[model samples]
Target: MTGFCNMVIISLFNWIYILSFFVVYTADAGVQNHHVDKQNNSKRLLMDENYYTIMSRLDNLTKEVEALKKENALLRHSPIAFLAELTKTVSGQNHQIHFDQVKVNIGNAYYPSHGNFIASVNGLYQFSITACSTANHYVVLELTVNTSVVGKVLAGDTGYDECSSKTFLIQLSSGDDVFVQHKSQGDYLLSASAYGFPSFSGVLLRAL
Candidate 1:
């Protein structure tokens, strides 16, 4: 009877120990699985943040590209040159010579009514003037920029019909005015014809 009781007690103790080991193992496995899950979640969050940052940068780049395209389109369509000629004989001192006939007025910068070129943009510009004098008469033509003399041309006083021309380069601001005026005194007749009319021209060389 004592041997049977001892065997029964030993078996009970063994069973209790096995149950405790199984409990410990289950708890440890659960902890390890939780740690793995936490690590995976952190990686997923970091990946999401990186994705958002990349998308924002791409959006800004697209906006900048669109702005550049619009600026290029505006530059391609702008106009900047003119050519004109006098329609009637002009003479005398300090007279603003109105070239009333427009041949190629690009941008409409040159006005035939007032005979002036008004700059629409700030830029480097080139201007030219041509004048023809009647036989035995002389005339002087001046190119003026906003009331300042910038260039001049002299036709003949040498007893024959003669033509003279001058070209000038200047920097102009927006709203500046350029025109031609008679600069000499006395009865000097300036002539115009289909073959050789007094002419004026201007072009914007480069925009600032």
Candidate 2:
């Protein structure tokens, strides 16, 4: 069933290709001068008819191509999406947070296994990090973009709920990396329980 559907789509694309050439060729034909003597009134009339016919065909083909593009877009899925969170508890003073489980990764630009989010395009981005601290301990996380600290989240202690989250909005160029890092703050650590663990998430605001 899938094979048949794919074949049908391929045929449609081929039709589009053929139609595009015909439109361009026909338009060019009308502009190119062709020699005709004064006695060739009938030949000129035939040429006019042919031009009109070609134009009508071109218009029809253009509409068909637009329709096909719309349908094709609906059938196509976005290959680049950025949305994920950590599945395991990650904590280290100088260690990067390895998310380990990606919920939605369209471009595969982010690697949870490596705790890195490499920007695939230059764009404005909004990043967020939620660090859960162990009871009586502390958690301080830093959001780093290209080795520069952009934001920080400090939470955990017997006083607070032991959850700290921070969101940052920044402009990133292609190949830049944004990630969360554990900052040295005593013996405090990031913790996760039945509710949820630490997570890092971000999305492209707009491509530059």
Please identify model 2 stretches exceeding 4 Å from their true place: 1-80, 90-92, 159-161
Error of 1 at 193 (Å): 1.3
Candidate 1's residue-wise lDDT over 1-208, tens digit each?
9999999999999999999999999999999999999999999999999999999999999999998887676466477999998868866676888888899998989999999999998888999999888877788788899989888888875666888888899999999999988865444646558447889999988776
lDDT for each candidate structure: 0.85, 0.75
Judged by whole-model lDDT over C-alpha atoms, candidate 2 comes out at: 0.75
Distance from true position, residue 88, model 2, in Å? 3.6
Q: Predict model 1's lDDT versus the native.
A: 0.85
Model 2 error, position 201 (Å): 0.6
- On lDDT, the leading prediction is 1
Q: Tell me the TM-score of model 2.
A: 0.57
